[model samples]
Target: MNLEEYIKENTATFDAFLQDFLSINLTNHSAKLLEAMNYSLLNGGKRIRPLLVMAFAQNLDIKKEYYMNVALAVEFVHTYSLIHDDIMDDDDFRRGQLATHKKFDIPTAMLAGNSLLTWAFQILSDESTHPNTEVRNYLTGFLSSSSGHTGLAYGQSLDLEYQFGNKNADYKKILKMHDLKTARLFKFCTRAPFVLCNPKILLNNKKTEHLDIFGTNFGLIFQATDDLLDYRDLDKSVDLGNIMSYKNNDEVVNYCKKLAKEALASLKNLEIDSQVLTELIQFIIIRKS
Candidate 1:
């Protein structure tokens, strides 16, 4: 089975779901900043995070449209991070389009990012969104861990502080930065669906442990890919240039591939479809900037 072809088949579903969640609902006067938020959030790109949410859910036999909401919530969180990253870096373009701040103004873009970030929590906290309150709560808790002190925002803070001659920085510090900055949330993505699949909730404790392990490895692979992409774009001057301290782009990709193998191996006892999971691994290693 062609993974690309399978992705194509699922593209429409992802797109439709994205549109509904990101639809420009707030009036312009109510929050003109929302326009810029919507602009960046709705910008054309591969919806990989959301796809991961649904794909993992499907792999576990938890088939339901409710996964759509969870997936979109993940996307919203990711987009909010990107918007803030652009503003903090004073970036001009994102995915070949004007960054949120550039499209509107700095304050507007910042507010927009804030709005999206909070919206993610709102969606996740809504018990009605998913039948399994355990799943919803598990995801929300992990997201909370990933979004704040334990995750991206916390990681970003340390990264910025390191840049301004915070002399105590070291490889471990950078590694922690990568974990919280890029990897932690991905760990949340890969493992959260398992929480949703606890039919009798008998596997709750064991599955939570298993999922945590899976998420950590998955997070490493994902962060390594980001490093690889930046290393490749060295000529183009892209990448955050911190946390992922690789020797070069080739090393970054190889590291990511190796880490992905370890992560995939952790699932060997499971009965997940090999072909689909293999394709995911390929995407992790060979993705372009």
Candidate 2:
């Protein structure tokens, strides 16, 4: 299938999966907390991160059921990050709706975010996620490191520091922050399939290294596009003083295209058909949202 068609089909399946996976008993004492969590978890963002996991796994002949929880774990971590990020950034809206903190109280939103973060690991650790205990442990470690202090959290910290303390932050510093904050998780999304099927592939295979590099570029493209979109939304001229040092919209767009090309190139050595991944790279650059 074509990329758009593939994404449409998988997005529907993943959304349905999320609905059932996130369902909580209304009569429970923490029903309100569960409600807030569900509100944000079910928010209609393009499920790109989870889709990446599935896309990468597909090439390895992995069944969707085998990797479904892994994909969901990525989404949960992503959602948790969003909830906390909205709170920290004091953002009122997300995906064109009230952010978790705004929809619910700050404390409720915080707890929901925390709960999702914890549950990501919980899902990774569950026996139903994978038959092999070693594989589950590997995934647990991978998810933890990707979302914990050295990965997403570190990136967020750098971003906050730059926004509040380092008005003169340069392009390199900003890129490092983005890599940690954004690219690390994408790295996991793309590479974890290898870890699941054969952990040694990641350790010894050159193609696996290429996949990791692809994810790194993908993450950069995702974040750069976001910055460009934000600039467009604000009707602001491109400013070098901004977090990224792009001189104009063309520069940002060109950079995204460059990253997409690099990402596509990285898949050249893989034996599997990677048309969906190639299209995804292209889609990342052109996506409006």
Per-model CA lDDT versus the true structure: 0.71, 0.83
Candidate 1 local Cα displacement, residue 195, angstroms: 1.8
- lDDT winner among the candidates? 2
Clashes of each: 0, 0
Q: How good is model 1 by TM-score? A: 0.86
User: Per-candidate TM vs. native?
Assistant: 0.86, 0.93
The window of 10 residues in a row where model 1 has the poorest summed lDDT is 237-246
Candidate that would win on TM-score: 2
Candidate 2 lDDT over residue span 28-115, tens digit each: 5468898887888888978999899888887786766667888988998999999999999899999889999999889999999999
Per-residue alpha-carbon lDDT of candidate 1 for residues 14-126, written as tens digits (9 for 90 to 100): 88766665554454635687677768777886777776777787777665656666776778888888889888878899889998898888888888888888888788778
Candidate 2: residue 150 lDDT (0-100) = 85
True lDDT of residue 261, candidate 2: 77
Off-target runs (Cα >4 Å) in candidate 1 are 24-31, 132-134, 162-168, 199-206, 235-246
